[model samples]
Target: MAIDPTSPPTSPPRDTPRLSTRDKLILFVLCAANFMVALDFSVLNVALPVLGADLGMSQSALQWAVTAFALPSGGFLLLFGRIGDLYGRRKLFLTGLVLFAAASLLATFAWDPASFLTGRALQGLGAAVIVPSGMSLLTTTFAEGPARDRALGISGTLMSLGFTIGVVAGGVLTDALGWRSTMGLLALFALIVLPLAPGLLPESRTPDRPHLDVPGAITVTGGLLSLIYALTTAADHGFGRADVVVTLIAGIALLTAFAVVESRTDAPLVSLSMLRRRTVAWGNLGGLITFSMMSTVVFVLTLYLQEILHLSAWETGLVFGVQGIMAVIAGSLTPRVVSRLGARRTLVAGLTGQGAFMIALLFLNEHSWSVWLAAVAVSLASMPHVAAIISYGLTVTSGVPDEEQGLATGLVTSTQQVGITIGIPLLGVLATTSDDLLSGTRLVMGIDAAILLVGAALIALGLRTWRSAGSGAVEAEPVGSR
Candidate 1:
């Protein structure tokens, strides 16, 4: 049965629905698809030097390998999300899967920088469709309760692990096989998931869903593209460059125009009122904070280990591999934790734990032993970090109507991608401003921890209001609703 946001659910919020074998297979297909999307974000990092050397890309131009994927990926998310809702999500999902696979193969076989960059950009465009579509599909498949919670826990775990594992896998694959193998691996994943999806996942067929919002789509997509480009460019070059400055202005202006257009349009691309909901607003902000701060932690620590501690790429990867292991453990246990404590409290506590560990990394230095200490910090922190990641997803999708799950999940997916894309640049800029690399790393970590604490406080306050207003469950009534 479909659900409306304002009305109470037909079933008990915490009731567990039994999953059939078919349901389990559907869950696997959806989560695996999302895992592939997450893997694309970081799997190419260790291969970049090799890729650039082979493709004749300069140091400045090399960043484009990653940036190329990020631009269209982040930019077109909302547009494609709306399209999936209006058209058929299953078709969109298949299209993205095929596009991603083809693009990955293209990048794998490219003989020139132009071709490689084109392939990467197209991969990003495919990712823009996959993430929101996959997420919306998952939510709509299972009702909002215990079964959905379990599925989300698995999805969140895989999503977090995909990022950390990508770094390690990139190094290993680049060493064993050529750099091309990394791109080839994603295409392989698509081959496996594509066949499963077509047979299993249900297509979107909401009768009351609105028509395409052309003006809203144009303004928002333009705004996101400009803004993401500015951020990605600013990471390498400062914000003062002519291109960066112009894009930054264009992004802001276009987004502001988008807001105005959304307000006046009969069929808005994104519902402005949805953004005003206590859970939707604060939940997305929480996701952005967790993803940006935690991901920046990994990056800053990786650089600190390599540059200051003189650890090799292999050693640095080992240090961070512990994070992936701990993330898996934490993700598996999160359903039980959420069952005991609601998503609201779980989010707050998770932030507190994650922030505490983040602050502990401030002591990192050049000593060899600091590597172990850093590893410990990240390992312990991964539990709560994973917790925050899962809980934020649970929180945001809790009260949304079934028809708008695409829009709701789109908002969160945008935050996750934008956070990954923006974190390095925003914090990397701060880390580099100081002449002392170690000091700059610590400065950024400290700032990130502070932001987490402040975010936790604000989110708690927001959820408290939501509870007082009679919606006791901050997320789904199910224990592992993420």
Candidate 2:
């Protein structure tokens, strides 16, 4: 007889505590690891031009540098999360850090584009494990209330700060030491995190879960890789190619099979029933849209800055510096905003603001050098989004027990990555199909606005569901939850 994977194994009763010295240390190590992960996400953007020159690659090949990391990380989240639950999160976290560091070293030494991409793909695999385990550790360490709130707040703030600073750091490194050194720095950081993990973090266990779902894991992972490759190929060669069509069909078929398998498995990787939870499903849907809008806009803007404005890599990075500063500020202020506005309202407002900013981009041009407009809009747009993301993360995590937090966080992260991966190609289609860059940008921006508005509407529906659920429940509500 098999056990139900949807039901997490029980541990001793949870003990939530104030920020102990150990808690702070755990936070420090995890944050360092997360910064390195987030750093890799945008760090390569600054180096793409230099890399293209060095490797004799085309625009399409350059995009793969980023996509290779994203697709695997997103696709394998459920698999890694389930593994974490079955084994131990601490073990997985340490393992992931080591793998990530090794991959970084490989990336630093690569002389060819293919070798470099292979390293990045490995880095993504490591991140798929690290991210969920880290989140689960944090969720388990801090119990509900002020302790959990502050821990999550600090974590969220540092992550946003990492995104802001990584670009600058990556640019400076690219200019001074070359693109390879950017990866080397990450390797060094990962090494520093290794020794600290042993004493700082506590191990978590789920002894009752079944063995890892190998069949489901392979199916989902293979499906996502195929789908992403097809989309990327479409961006470069158009969708008319037979290879693209075949890959796309195969990917869809495998994913459909994976879903069917999950329905019958005693210990499925991702419990489809969780999606039935209003908080989980709606939160993920909003995350997908918000991330898509953010990523699509940035994808188009990077090209505009480089091709149209002819800004140096460092200067282009500097242009985004203001938005980074704003993100830090917004991240720090998120808890307060969530407390005042409620999670649902905050999310809806954030989605609306982000949509408006993207729509406004339809008017930007080669004549528009007004950096302040972009900076201000980004800063303002970031505030609500940060607040909403952090709040919703807490809300969803709170709905589940500690052991499953890894799976929960992984699901959310995966959805966000999916948004990012799809954003470029989806918008690239609209942007590049036109004869002129400006026309393409406008068309893509309009699509982004529409998508964001749809997300905002979904959030609005979520708000109503949250209120209705709250009215019927007897438990004291979370501070940010209405």
Candidate 3:
């Protein structure tokens, strides 16, 4: 069927019913939840100095305030994803909201470093539960088609905007009302979302109530937690630190064990079969590369803007702020493009465009013109990210039964978090090892561009193989829907 540019993107299955007022409200709530999760990562960054002074924390200890949140957030995702599948998504999501809000309140009133860290850790746990559950809620509610694509597009946009908003808001809030204000804002957002969730969100779970794979959960969660810790630590201490080396090895061992356990377990936390699916496997690899490189791009640019060009914190925020706006615009338009081009091609275009933009940044310099150019490049880079995120989700969840939506959602979310956790250290190691900061930044950018280009090619080739195998019917159905 030819796509009608005048109408909303149509799904391949059939004409999906137009979204009702209630559906729109539900999308809003889910997107808000996702935005809250994404915002927490960057919002506290600007407040670190003030928070440290207030809590009597050392510079190194202050970094924990961030790491503390990240550890459990990334660690508990797979476990929670399966939990949501067996239990009820609504139940898990509501519990997460309450926990997040309470944690935020605790952080807001914290008088000591221990208290603050505890609150942050709890917030991470809440987020871990919320992200997978919320994503499952989204995928299950929006049928696999253009409607889902559009919904995912909005979700991707909010998530991208959340990070940028956090950067900007952290500076403004900390300056205006102190570091606690950032925590207070989170509390307020959580509180606002908590009450409406029960009414707006629908309950869902797998029909058979599959048995929880305890051993599988333990190995996978432990493995992921250990790996994230190593990456986080490596960002600060380098890859060679004794603890980092030990933890990385341990993470690998446990994950290897996890794969073994899953292959044997009747009710595995992750279905090894899902991993075998071309869309699920390659889409995730594409997502990992996209997130890892995008993060590094931002990290390098932050240093360039602040250290090399002497831009103030607020000025740096403004530069990236423009990029965020572009991301939102790109996200809004993506569903239409996907409707016309198909998800695989859309993903390829997005990845290719991102690489092109990153290559443009290799020429960046201390000149003011370069600053605007860098901003434009970053902005353009985000456009593809929006498409890739939405397409990847569709690719992973398409054809997946409702019972396993949580598992698919969990896998995608875990890949994203792990990608983010490793990006800084992975790229930072290269940049820091160079003779000069500029040289390192250029090298990293060049390498990232190459990786993205390669990823795009791989995805393109995978699509070609699928088409050649007489399985092109799968592509016509939806990116991932059977």
- What's the TM-score of every candidate structure? 0.94, 0.88, 0.94
RMSD of each: 4.3, 6.5, 3.7
**In model 2, which residue pairs have backbone atoms overlapping below 3 Å?**
none
TM-score of 2: 0.88
Backbone collision tally, model 1:
3
Give per-residue CA lDDT, model 1, range 1-482, as digits (tens). Answer: 33332344444445344689999999999999889988898899988998888889999999799889999999999888878888878899999999999999999999999999999999999999998888889988877656667788889999999998898889889999989999999999988998888889899945776778888999999999999999889988988899999999999999999999999988898988888777777788889988888888888887888889988877788888988999999988886666556566677888888999988889888788898989999989999988988878888887777788888889989989888877878887887777999999999999988988999998886666344111223432222222
Tens digits of per-residue lDDT, candidate 2, 1-482, equal 21221222232212233577877888888878877787778777778888888877788688788778877777777778778888999999999999999999988998888888899999999988888888888878777554665567667666655666777787999889998888899899899999899888898968576777788889988887778777767766777889789989988998998899889998777677765566677767777777767767766766677777777767767777777777777776665554444445556767887787776677767765645555565566666556656665665565576667777877777775676666776777777677888778778878888888887886676545353121111121232454
Off by over 4 Å in 3: 1-17, 467-482
lDDT of each: 0.84, 0.73, 0.85
**lDDT per residue, candidate 3, 1-482, as tens digits?**
43422233444433324799999999988999899999998899878989999899998898699889999999999999999999999999999999999999999999899999999999999999999999999989987777788788899889888988898899888988999999998999999888888999999999899789999999999999899999998887798899899999999999999999999989999988888777778778878888888888887888888877788888888888997898889888887776666666677788898998999989987777878888888988899877787777766776678898999899989988988888899986787666777788888899999999999998887655442111111332233532
Error of 2 at 372 (Å): 2.8
Which candidate number would show the highest lDDT if scored against the true structure?
3
Whichever of 1 and 3 has more lDDT, that candidate is: 3
User: What is the TM-score (0 to 1) of candidate 1?
Assistant: 0.94
Model 1 ranges off by over 4 Å: 1-18, 468-482
